[model samples]
Target: MRFLVIFLLIAKIYADDHELHSKHHIYKELSHLDLTKEQQHRVKKILKIYRKELKEYKELEEDIEDKRKDIFLQKSFDLEKINSLNQQLDREAHGIENRFLQKMHFVLTPQQRKKFVHYFDDWEVE
Candidate 1:
């Protein structure tokens, strides 16, 4: 029983590691970049800022969902409010992504920047 428990624990740990290293696509790409200590620190800082924005986005998502529900359930439908909420969602999404990408590019060196661009096929430095 002891041996079985130990084996299961090790397997679980390995599974978690694989999930983090393999399943997290961005982290896997970042590991390939070979960042220096300062570069890593700067990248972490950039990610921190991104996380804050992401939190806001999550909250905004909840609000949007509630707004959608409230709109649909109302006795009188309001198309204008729905349109306004959609526009706000679009603007926030674009702003968060553009801001994060720019700051991330700024922290990386020229070579790292090239790698980042290459790794993220959709994103260009220009």
Candidate 2:
């Protein structure tokens, strides 16, 4: 019984780590732009801020999912609660973009901004 419990715990931890890595890989792929050192540093700072927001968003999403599951199991729904949570999630999403843009604007020159836009245009979000 103890061995089984240990194995399950290890598996759960591994799965969590894998999920975190996968998320990081996806974000890296989506944001893969060839940047100079200065550009990279500035973008890294922006991404750092984004990472914190994303972590919170993921927790909120998990909470929302748990609520959804509870509703389904109970054969009841709370539309207002769900909507409120969703609105908060939406605000966080918008805040992520706005904060990133604000940071970028402060860190990048006009020419750099143009280049950054081109890079983003070239990137496929998928």
Candidate 3:
């Protein structure tokens, strides 16, 4: 049916968007690390968990955006409702990211943690 087709298309688009987000963060983090084989294996395992969390976060964000778009497209749009939903999505995403960072910090040594922090600082300024 036409409705089914449209639903499938939208699902695929959202899935691709999530994949892109996960890949971008993974590549960025990996680029910053100088990992030995063992370290690389550990990092990969950590990243696997992070990526799953990120994918869920991304899906939540996409759902929020879709809802906002639907509201705006209606004749009687509620900006306040959309804003509240967006804020909730933002908070949830931030919480997930913070948890991931905490896990990553726990896994790294003091020196590695400093290196990770320095990498992010440098990355931000560049």
In order, candidate lDDTs are 0.63, 0.56, 0.60
RMSD of candidate 2 to true structure, Å: 10.8
Query: Which 10-residue span in candidate 2 carries the lowest summed lDDT?
Result: 6-15
lDDT of 1 by residue, 15-114 (tens): 4444343234334437667777666656656655655665577689789989989998999999999999988887886787798788877777788777
User: Once superposed on the true structure, which residue ranges of model 3 sit more than 4 Å away at CA?
Assistant: 1-41, 121-126
Candidate whose lDDT is highest: 1
The TM-scores of all predictions, comma-separated, are 0.66, 0.57, 0.61
Candidates arranged by lDDT, highest first = 1, 3, 2
* Model 2, global lDDT: 0.56
Q: Model 2, range 19-126, lDDT digits (tens) per residue?
A: 455344334543444455566555555655555565565677678778767766776677777787778767866676677677877877776677667655322111
Worst-scoring 10-residue span by lDDT in model 3 = 2-11
For candidate 3, report its TM-score.
Answer: 0.61
Stronger candidate by lDDT (1 vs 2): 1
